[model samples]
Target: MGALADNRRFWLACNLVTLVLHAFGVYLYASEGFAHPVAQLWAIVLMLHMLEFPLAFIAVRERRIGWGVTIMATLIFGFTWWVPTRRGVFHA
Candidate 1:
């Protein structure tokens, strides 16, 4: 793999970490009701991710991807998942 591929992998790994953190944050909020500051931070991040959802929806639609998977992936990975996907990097 070249530099570009390595860069993409790095971003993908970051995305994975982001996903895990968000999930854990949500779990904390659900279980503890914002007792932790992380849970409060998660709410803000979720809102930001919600804003990214429409862009992800359009990108996935342009690629003729299914709505269900697109929704889940976009909610989880946001720009890191959709940008390269739109550029045909994953297919390449």
Candidate 2:
């Protein structure tokens, strides 16, 4: 699983899926609100992602990444973005 995670294609697919989920979550939350179980779940997931920001901040600082990009990517992809980034797997 660790080896699979190092693949760029794998990360790309993961990020895309994450992006789609977030988009769907936003739409659902806006339309149906937390009254829907799925929307509530997505809201919880989003909150969890927000909680991950401090960790992302620490990991990304050493790489000289700008705060805005780091925050957005971490919120969107969580470990999918930060883990590979910290491991230098995204580089040649």
Candidate 3:
């Protein structure tokens, strides 16, 4: 395959790792009944972090979206969506 395709596949694999890691972390927290400091907050943040990529793009495309929001989202979602969609479109 081409370089772009290869690069995307690599990032997709990394995204999968991110998803699994966050899920595992959340699972550990849940197992403890979320008694630790900000465990609930961690769960919420990590889960949202996983979706931040796709959501950022959606935010950018919306007509009513603000530049500030888009910029912040882009910054937060950097490389998470950047690699997979580097070609101006994503494979999946």
Best by lDDT: 2
Cα distance off (Å), candidate 1, residue 80: 1.5
| Deviation from native of the Cα of residue 16 in model 2, angstroms | 1.6
Model 2 residue 49 distance off true place after TM-score fit, in angstroms: 1.0
**lDDT minimum window of 10 residues, candidate 1:** 1-10
Q: Per-candidate TM vs. native?
A: 0.74, 0.83, 0.43
How many residue pairs clash (N, CA or C atoms closer than 3 angstroms) in each of the candidate models, in the order given? 0, 0, 0
Descending-lDDT candidate ranking? 2, 1, 3
Over 1-92, each residue of candidate 1 has an lDDT whose tens digit, in order, gives 35664476776787888888798898999999888888988877767777888898787676887777677776777777777777665541
> Could you tell me which residue pairs clash in candidate 3?
none
| TM-score (C-alpha, index-matched) for candidate 2 | 0.83
RMSD of 2: 2.1
lDDT of 3 at 88: 47
- Rank all candidate structures by their TM-score, best first, as comma-separated numbers: 2, 1, 3
Error of 1 at 8 (Å): 3.1
What C-alpha lDDT values do all the predictions have? 0.75, 0.81, 0.56
Mark the 10 consecutive residues where model 2 has the least summed lDDT.
83-92
